[model samples]
Target chain A: MNTTATLSRIFAGIQPELDQVDALFQERATSGLAILNSASMHALASPGKRLRTALTLLAGKLNHYDFGKLLQLSVAFEMVHLATLIHDDIIDEAATRRGNPTVNALWGDKIAILLGDYYLAKTSGLIAEIENPRIDHLFADTVATVCEGTIMEMMTSGRADLTVETYFEKIKNKTACLIAACSKGGAILSDATDEQVEFLHSYGLNLGIAFQIIDDILDYTEDQSTIGKPAGNDLRQGMVTLPLIFALQEASQNGHQQQVQALLNSDEHNEKDILEVVDWVTHGYGVDLSLQEAHNYANKAREALYHFPASSDRDVLDELIDFVISRRR
Target chain B: MNTTATLSRIFAGIQPELDQVDALFQERATSGLAILNSASMHALASPGKRLRTALTLLAGKLNHYDFGKLLQLSVAFEMVHLATLIHDDIIDEAATRRGNPTVNALWGDKIAILLGDYYLAKTSGLIAEIENPRIDHLFADTVATVCEGTIMEMMTSGRADLTVETYFEKIKNKTACLIAACSKGGAILSDATDEQVEFLHSYGLNLGIAFQIIDDILDYTEDQSTIGKPAGNDLRQGMVTLPLIFALQEASQNGHQQQVQALLNSDEHNEKDILEVVDWVTHGYGVDLSLQEAHNYANKAREALYHFPASSDRDVLDELIDFVISRRR
Candidate 1:
């Protein structure tokens, strides 16, 4: 089955709740300022997978699913994700996201930055209404970690000496922690046992790691038409991801290390150099090794589901692992 | 007395608590990331007036002053202010602030943006520790207003038709809202009565309006050596503040309106054109008129204090109103 078909099947049980999340998000994101309202509406038009929202709702389903609280949690987490994506586009200086013009592309960077902050503030307001200190602290620490990860990424840009360990560290903070927070927050909202929250958090964390690893892989393996971004875009930005790190390790033994290092360390990346590095990673063991690592995490995520009983929600979450690993975009 | 001498006297009662706020800020801002740590440390080095911190501390002193919660509130609010400044400098493309190089100037916009996010995240963490939903909602709303005001400013930039009412709305959101949040947050931390909280909020709001009006006036009246930024800096950026607005109104009747309008609405401002507009606003009734408006807000601020009984803290708060209006920089 295709990705959308699979996601529809997985989320069918919570479709009504998901629709409400979208409605609430749109309602909350609307502002009195015409420019902000229009810019934000444009941004909302090109929606991502809403994976975090799904995780929150699904995790809440495993216990007491108060639709009201879960809706707030889902919307807030998704808004945080959206806010980060907007800011990330500004930092990446990318004109397109999901094959559509980015907020920064349509408006200037100043508006984009403020829009991101606006979303964050909106997220804070929603979280405050929830009035759970544990959830509040979880979301706060997750955001802080995400910021730290972004800083680390910026500081490490163009440095070919990045280790696989550090790469994992960066992605964990950048992507995984927030995903974990979503699952954990939903569990907290549902008044789940601490053990159940921990289980869901672990499930989300491992799943998130797998999600990002596949994302890095797709950056090299898929074309713009397939992935909604140019192939090897990360390499063009001098970002050394897991595949690149693995490729460099393999190239060291194959005598291509110096050339790759020189290309990456240069002030600007030419298309030729970016393509060459992409070829090296794609045609070598890098993608294969990274895929294996992703599978390992995917397996961990699958195992985490066993901690919960064999409910329909757990079944969907279990299928989500396969979807995350196999989705093209 | 000098501005510093007067401020010292006003803040003397809370010197030790102020010291602790500084220490805690420095401690909290220190990060394991070397780049972020050094940049944040540099930002902390050239501190602002810490007027928000003083307002928070003094407001808390009016009732129960729990040192721990007040410290957290003060530090969190100040960090939010610092975060906004960092992002604002990026928006303004400013190289210097308070006679010191900005984070964007020292590192780059990317790092500066991330650093601002880091501070905001740090602020959320501190506020979570306080665990008060009311304070959290107040801060979140304040930040949202601040972002709205900033976006309003950006949208209105280079438009010569900005009105005085819109100008007041802009400054109220951009500056006064956060200041109001600080005082209200302090009152909340102190467990003050609802009436006292409203009074403090009103006082901070009026005081903040006065503060920003003076700031606008200073931009025209003070040179680089005095205000730590070039005179007419706002005009150079096409920011039509109160002084420029008042001057334009005056020039409309005096037959110099077209020239000033042409100068302001132009694509780029030449130094000569900037100086010409500055001369008109500074030499005309603009400065005097703007100062009178600021004093009006100052009086409102002072009147807000009459609700509280006479005490040293209230006295200090009253003196703060005078200090705000009379400060040269």
Candidate 2:
């Protein structure tokens, strides 16, 4: 969690600014509404790596971004992230996140849903403070796009005919669009040229796709502790991620698709078979293939930043391409 | 369902405009996201009487409201209503709303939550189009307030010592604030005087409180076919509404507190006793007393409209105060 070990060294200029963003994010998330304040306080206490917030800050460094508006928009982006995660836990019926009691675990799905909604409101409220109609519309539209992505994923869940293209579409909606919104928003607030904004948006989108690919890959490569939940829970929930999708494609090519199909069809009580699938995915070229895809997106993200003048901020943004792919969690 | 019997004659002026609002609401609810579109289209098909929408339209009649902005805001209000209902079904574990399949019932809680979130995004997106910062802030704050109210209600779900103050607070949040937002938004969009805006706000708040009180009353008094759920479902779900609160107070005074307490304490086996409590409440002036409180709120709501001169729109608005109190469902 000591991003200072990595990002701090590269972001010597905006480190203090990043810290202020963190402080304000923590403060703003604590609402005057008692339940939201307490629940969000609990959730924000075990914060994510703030990769999204840092993305906004780094993108802002591309031009003369208003610090205040940037901080507010950054908070808005993180709250959107929090709101989705809170709702996701309810859908996943997850009891914990990163070993901390999920909102649903602490308070039932009822409170969890409401608290998620509270975060949604806070997200809107923060964006409204910025009073930028274009940004507000972007955030709202991104929210719908995110929902669309997940709903499509659910619609295709447990199906035998999951396509590679459909999987990319799902991940783009579920993960990448919000990342693009964050960077695009930051760039919009900055005195950046249209080219710079377009570049950052593309950078964020590519990086987001790459980040989620690695995350899906980690579901099999990493242990429970490193990944924060049981390994292969996605498969357990009948969700097919990139690694599993790639692995299944390989299985079909090798004519072992029947075994993989049997594993997919079996609901539970197929621990030995589940392990077999995991082994096929890990020991085979599944991890390698997925990592290759991630590397490709990360390279594209790097290329998107090719036109930007080299600065400490742009340098750190470029380094995130590697950090996103290499990080354990 | 035939609003014609009541509002048609009075709303001849705004008939076409209201139709436009409905058409746009239907059009906007559908998304490129098929699941969201289908689910929302289904929910919108079984729409409530659009009491909240009517309130905005009727309030707009007070002055020269921007028909475009008012229509958009009204649709936004309704979407907010729809979103809350979608999530509330998850909380209530309700299979149907108004005798139609709830999103949760058809697609399970995960899809239901996601669809509800999509509606929320649509809500914010619609408001962002209006480009009014104060109105935007009001809607966002209203959402948080609504969540706070519902969370508090869930927190106090099954207590022997539920306070009337707390009960009012819950209804005000769960039901009233959005109504207030609708009317306030209407007034804001209109060329209404500031005093007129204040009056409409008060009218909305009081009317909303009355509307919910009657709704709770209907839960006990109406049959399953009428209310869309079983009679006394509120108490069955460990929820204490206005009628039950009054019934418990009466039982205490009449020395039948143990009977009421026993029924509340019992799980599901005491259907007979629950019926007995309902009988006692219904046959024993519970409905009368609850209606009396509703009448009080209705009178206050009417008082807010006293300053408005005679007009058909005002006439309809005045009649709604009584309609909310007198109507069965």
Give the winner by lDDT: 1
A135, model 2: CA deviation in Å?
0.8
Provide DockQ values for all models, in the order shown.
0.88, 0.79
| Candidate 1 regions with alpha-carbon error over 4 angstroms | B1-5, B253-255
Per-residue lDDT for B56-114 in model 2, tens only? 88898787867888899989998898899889999989887777888889989999899
Model 2 Cα interface RMS deviation (Å): 1.0
**lDDT (CA) for every model shown?**
0.89, 0.83
Residue-level lDDT tens digits of model 1 in B1-329? 65666777788988988899999999999888999889988988864547889999999999998889999999999999998999999999999988789999999898988898888889999999999889899889999999999999998887566789999999999999999998889999999999999999999999999999999999998897777778998887878899888877877544565666687778777889788888889999889999999999999998888899999999999988988999987
Per-residue lDDT of model 1, residues A1-329, tens digit only = 65666787878988988899999999999999999889878888865547899999999999998989999999999998888888999999989987789999999899999999999999999999999999889988999999999989988887777899999999999999999898889899999999989999999999999999999999999997676767888877888899988887877544566676687778777888788878889999999999999999999988878998898888889989989999887
What residue pairs clash in candidate 1, if any at all?
A: none
> Candidate 2, overall lDDT?
0.83
Q: List residue ranges in candidate 2 displaced over 4 A.
A: A1-13, A31-35, A252-254, B1-12, B251-258
- How does model 1 score on DockQ? 0.88
The TM-scores, chain A only, for the candidates as listed are 0.96, 0.94
Clashing pairs in 2: none
Ten contiguous residues minimizing lDDT sum, candidate 2 chain A = A1-10
lDDT of 2 at A129: 94
